[model samples]
Target: MENLNIGQHISRRYNEELEDIRNRVLAMGGLVEQQLKDAMTALEKRDAGLAAQVVERDCEVNAMEVAIDEECNRVLARRQPAASDLRLVVAVIKTITDLERIGDEAERIARMVSTLVREEHSTRLFTQIRNLGHHVSSMVHGALDAFAHLDTEKSVEVWSEDRLVDDEYDSLMRELMTYMMEDPRSIPSILQAMFAARAMERIGDRAGNICEYVIYLVKGKDVRHTRVDKSG
Candidate 1:
């Protein structure tokens, strides 16, 4: 799937560095994926212990981002990669940034479970939020897969998933606002849920952003803004 051959370099060290950094990016992706899952599970199950773990593990994500970024910088300084190699380095740098922010969103969602007052969520509210969470989770996975393979088609599909995520977010937020307005007593708890959902929505956006970077890396197209309405 990948057009750029990472192992084609003359310097064995250069090839190893490129491959190692790619692996690190994937490892970071896996970590963020787990963080997102744990955070949503914590919210849905009201498991404070698991939520605390997610929050504490966030530092590991930050550290991975820093390490991979340093590696990318070193590759740029020493190898001075040109053509596709250059794009690969640039894409790795951008992907890790989004992954770190995704980790932050997960941490924020987990915090809501521990810090917010306990109020039983309405069935409808929980259902909508759960659906949104699942959709964003899929998008995140798809984004990483697209990047791993340099699959522009897969990247575009993941980018389009953002529209569905946004619609769900809007629907969920509207319901939450209505609930809050109807019962002022539930305002605090519902607000917490709303914020968590907002974080999930942002995760979807970031996942799509990562897909855009994949397209940039593969097709050399800067599609971030113009690709917003893309579905085909």
Candidate 2:
């Protein structure tokens, strides 16, 4: 009887911890989304103030990641949960890492925006960069939504959007390359545009990682490197 009671108590505690972790992850996602939005806006408007704010606010995302990691560790040590509970804890750990990377990508975008603000460089590449940012931010938002809803199918759908981001990035690269080839003087701007495109591509990759974790939590399958049919 005592063991049964203890099991029930542990179960309750584990559930509470899971809920807390979910809330923390959601909050972290909110911060990352905001960072991406602010960075993109700063880039579009050439607002140095907004870019500076994004750099300053990145510390909050880093701090939340640490807190979430600590919480996951505490739960694992105390609860020693199995089945779905274990999956939840593991998924949260993976998801937070992706979120942190997304935060870093946002910071990189802001730094690039700072440069543009300082120099006021006018180029055709800005449209490509802005479109790439839009696609990446949309994927990030969808991935978080899939995580919140625990919809494996939606997560898979979100994962597929990474390809669109990649295609846009490739187009941006080709466009820049054409400019650099046409005019030797375009090298510096072309290089900067390439870096910004690469950053957005990485953000898309991280969003895809989050989608993979969500699918793993729901389907109990690893779909990281091997692409399986997610038509279901």
Candidate 3:
């Protein structure tokens, strides 16, 4: 039964590799979540020091994405996994791409924080932006939790939260426009606030993408373009 033993060994090794890749994806998710949180805090506190730290940490997130991608490629080349294993690799790749995009959005927000602080914008406007940041950050955290647990229900919930973020974004844009119209001198700072709001909205979108990937991984369904109805 020598051939049987060899087959078992190969199977175990392949399973182990899959688990390793899954762990790496979750670790990357944690980093992205922290990046978003730090960026939002920086904006709220108007702390350039914290914003700078968030920008620097983005490089680490980028490196993790590359490393995980390379490992996925290696598994595909060496193992030639099929069926469920193939789906897992594809999902991991998509999830990491979205995670990287989220990190990019976080960095954009941090840069805006730096500028807004230097410009000495009104504290009232920053307060509203902070509220928006909290909402988007919660979405990101929910998406990551869904992926880690392979909970499709939670994934759908996270996907639904994006609409709320969109509404908040639209409201913020209107407020900024009113500010600019009322006082031309505030245009520069209001413009920066608009950019920061856009970045936060994009981060919410990326989080929704991650949720879609999770649903795909668990259900073998593509829900990207279609409406997701949690209720039967």
Best by TM-score: 1
Best by lDDT: 1
TM-score of each: 0.94, 0.91, 0.92
Model 1 segments more than 4 A misplaced: 1-3, 120-124, 228-232
The list of candidate 3 runs beyond 4 A from truth reads: 1-10
- Candidate 1, residues 1-232, lDDT tens digits: the string is 3467688888888889999998899999999999999998888887889999999999999999999999999989988888889999999999999999999999999988876525665334555588889999999999999988888889889989899999888988888999889989877778788889999999999999999998888766778679443332
Clashes of 1: 0
- Pairing residues by index, what is the TM-score of model 3? 0.92
lDDT of 3: 0.85
RMSD (Å) per prediction: 2.4, 4.1, 4.5
Judge candidate 2 against the unseen true structure and give its global Cα lDDT, from 0 to 1.
0.83
lDDT per model vs. reference:
0.88, 0.83, 0.85
Backbone clashes for every candidate come to 0, 0, 0
Clashing pairs in 2: none
Q: Assess the local accuracy of residue 137 in candidate 2 as a C-alpha lDDT between 0 and 100.
A: 92
Q: Alpha-carbon error at 157 in model 2, in Å?
A: 0.7
